[model samples]
Target: MTLYPATLLLHLVGVIGLFIALSLEVAVVSRLRVAKTTTQVHEWLTLSRVIDVLLPVSAVVILISGLVLTFSAWGWGHAWIELSLGLLVLLGLLGPVINGPRMKAIRVAAQAAPEGSISPALRQAIFHPVLRVYVPIPGLVALGAVIMMVLKLDWL
Candidate 1:
């Protein structure tokens, strides 16, 4: 009935959407890592495009709703809100800076490779060490933000 509850619902929806996108990305990356053929890689890459849409939409929803909530009910001084915002920024940066280019490279390699077993370059692109290390970071950061939000942690 009120703005706060409505905005909170929207924020929760955004969080759910974000996790859905992230989970899909995890699945796609896992599949890509072991994909045996160019067809498999291409299929998974197509699925990843769904994430390209979901992640940004969810993020924008979260940000706008969260800002409304912050200004209305929570104020700007809470440590948890600030930390959560920082985590959101980190997630925003990580996707474009780390995952975007790597996934693009994999897509490019998959497109160029002949229709057959995965090529050496495609394998290398899929299993890049940096991507492997980076995959869990966003999930962990999101989890931390959720924890802070729930607990309203203020130990700053």
Candidate 2:
């Protein structure tokens, strides 16, 4: 019956969008392990077009909406909010420096290889340590944030 409910709904949408992007990254890249043929690599890389826009846009929306929810109704001092905001900062960093570069490396390799010359090293780069670690970080943090919201834990 008030702005809180609407804002809450929007916030949920952003969360869903953010998770969807992360999930897709995991799914598509996992599939890459079995992927063969340069054309197939190109197709897999094409999946990025969907993710590239979804992640940042959803992140921005979440950040803006969270600020609104924080200042308007949820007090800034709440333990859960502070922790969630801290997780958000970590989330913001993960996409750009960690995941983004891994994806770009894959893209560059996919583009650089001669036609039909998809190599094992190229695939290894795609499944690099950074990406393996990076993929789950967002989802795990989001789940942690959700747990804090549900439990409403106190600041420690």
Candidate 3:
């Protein structure tokens, strides 16, 4: 019933949720790639609803629980904890405010268009920029967060 145990449980559950969401994305993207018609792609688009909901919720839980753990362990002044907490905040905000809406647009477009009507040029135009940037930012932030948590250094 302690804060530590509760936070740990929430963090673990958040990670599990994130893992499931990521797996769903991979499966859905693969299905989208192989889809020959709009109906097939639209069918796959339904998965986006799950991702759109779960991803941010899991991220928020992970971040809030992580911040609870950090604050409990290392007061607010601790550089590593602060850095990890900051990255978590960034992920939560950016995922929802920026990427989430863009993804929703893409999904809506996919669902609304007729089979084979989504032009290759339009597809690339719609997705390439987001695909290029959104994925890499998370990896870098995750790496920074892990290093901050593990090292617990005074890099401030």
CA lDDT scores, all candidates in order: 0.91, 0.82, 0.69
Compared with the true structure, what per-residue lDDT tens digits does model 2 show for residues 27-129? 8788766677778878877887888889888888888888899889978778888988888888888678887777888888887777776786677777698
How many clashes in each structure? Answer: 0, 0, 1
Off by over 4 Å in 2: none
Error of 3 at 63 (Å): 2.9
Please provide, for model 1 over 34-92, each residue's C-alpha lDDT reduced to its tens digit, 9 standing for 90 to 100.
88999999999999999999999999999999999999988988889998998898889
Q: Can you rank all candidates by lDDT, best first?
A: 1, 2, 3
TM-score of predicted model 1? 0.97
Off by over 4 Å in 1: none
Give the Cα error of residue 24 in candidate 1, in Å: 0.8
Candidate 1 residue-wise lDDT at 80: 92
lDDT of 3 by residue, 61-99 (tens): 987888788768656777777777777777777766666
| TM-score top scorer | 1
